[model samples]
Target: MIKQPSIVIIDYGVGNTQSVANAIKFLGYKNVKISCDFNDIENADALILPGVGAFEEAIQNIKKRNLVEILNYQVLDLKKPILGICVGMQLLATYSEENGKHEGLNWIKGEVKKLNLSREFSVPHVGWNDVIIKSKDPLFTKNTDLSNFYFDHSFYFDCYDEQNVIAYCDYDIKVTAAVQKGNIFGVQFHPEKSHNNGLKMFRDFINSIS
Candidate 1:
């Protein structure tokens, strides 16, 4: 089993796992598994962290599962491509201001702050939006036409390494829609909900390890 390549979706019970799994399957990936088991991390070739809800709750779940250290070690030391979606993306940073002050994975240098746009924009920033590809990365080899994708989040990260940002979207100012630093990747949008473009992105991510 160690020799087999599997895409493990870290099951912290925060995000839309079924949708993400379906997306991976739509991309022609057959070995996708959702697991909270620590051994699953070692056995898999790639990881996807899909999240939703409050930052504090999610952090507590990760900590309770004793997965914080493993996730950091895997992405930072193992040099594996770990993709985080939505609130999952926010968790890759050092801190978040969703409720009170909360610590995160700290794999990327940044803080998650609430959206402070004009009154015209909604608070959550839901629905379809464009993902403006900003940098060159294998995960985004599809194209760079400012592709439209689904986005639903109230908080976002202020990345320390701007170069790692592969895409951006408008909410009030330009918020990072996607990030890729070495092997760690993250997205603020729900790729599983973005239709064809999202499928392509997921496929590219799976192919990154292959």
Candidate 2:
């Protein structure tokens, strides 16, 4: 029998790690864990970085846990598949302009900037929005219902290279909903909270790793 890949949800003290874990477990993936320990991260076959806060705070929390080096080794050096959610997605950028200029993981070439929408559209960009698939990436292949992913964010990833963007949504202006660079992937929406549509996305992510 084939062994199930161990999936580690990096707990950097910035996201709903438990919720993400529950979702993964619900999908029947038994070898899932939430940890910040270097060994757990290094030994995992895949990683999930979930966040629900400011870019600066998230990055700082990750630094405090001494995860930068290990994460770099696993992601950049080993090329393990990773998925970043919401603010977690923003952390993969080159930098962010939220509050003040802050550096990110630089995994993908981009910057995080506030949604520059007019007064009518709101800033946080909460609730369900339709996703327009831009690339034929494997992570989005199984699902066709891309219209109702939950999103709660004030900022969005502004990828410098257009080729890296896999999907997008409209929030007054074009908001980047998803991105991918080699094995690195990110989504501005909260798939764990997005119900069935979100669950399918998790399944897709797991299948990609398999």
Candidate 3:
């Protein structure tokens, strides 16, 4: 039997690390852990950067923990696949306009900006919404329904290059739902909260890692 890869949920003093870990555990992947230690992060087969907070706060925490360099090395140099969720996904952009101009990991070429919508639409685009898949990325399979992924955020990733965006959600304006750049990947929605579709995403991500 092929051994399952060791997946690490990065705990950089921010994000819904526990909930993400729980979701992964629920999928029966026993070789998983939540840690901020550089050694553990470096040793993991794949990484999950999950967040549920302000963009500035998340980036600050990541830098405070001194994770920026290590993460860059792992994902960029080693080509290890990493998934950034919500604000975690926003962290992948070049910078964010939240609170102030803050620097991000810049793993994907993009900028984070607040949603510009009319009074009819809400600020934080909460609840379930469907995504329009733009690519044949393995994370989002064909058979799986592309609707009803949980989303809760006011800011969205604005890709500098449209090719980086794999999926989009229409909310007055086109909101980037998912992005992929070689081994790096990110999702604006929380798959952990999206029921079976979410679980399938986690499963697909795990399977995609070689």
Per-residue CA lDDT of candidate 3, range 1-210, in tens? 889899999998888999999999999999999998999998999999999989988998998899989998999999999999999899999999998899999989889999989899999899999888887568887324466699999999999999999888889999999999988889999999998888988888998999
- Candidate 3 residues lying further than 4 Å off, grouped into runs, are 142-145
Q: Pairs clashing in candidate 2?
A: none
* Candidate 1 ranges with C-alpha deviation above 4 Å: 1-4
Whole-model Cα lDDT per candidate?
A: 0.86, 0.91, 0.90
- Better by TM-score, candidate 3 or 1: 3
- In order of listing, the candidates' clash counts read 0, 0, 0
Cα lDDT of model 2 by residue, 1-210, tens digit: 778889999999999899999999998899999999888998999999999988999999999988999899999999999999999999999999999999999999998998888889987898999888877457777667355699999999999999998999978888999999999999999999988888988888988895
Candidate 2 wrongly placed segments (more than 4 Å): none
Write down the TM-score of every candidate: 0.95, 0.97, 0.97
lDDT of candidate 1 over 38-143, digit per residue (tens): 8989878999999988999998999998998888788888887799999898899989988899999888889999899999999888998877787746778875
Which candidate leads the pack in lDDT? 2
Of the two candidates 2 and 3, the one with more favorable lDDT, higher being better, is: 2
lDDT accuracy of residue 190 in candidate 3: 95
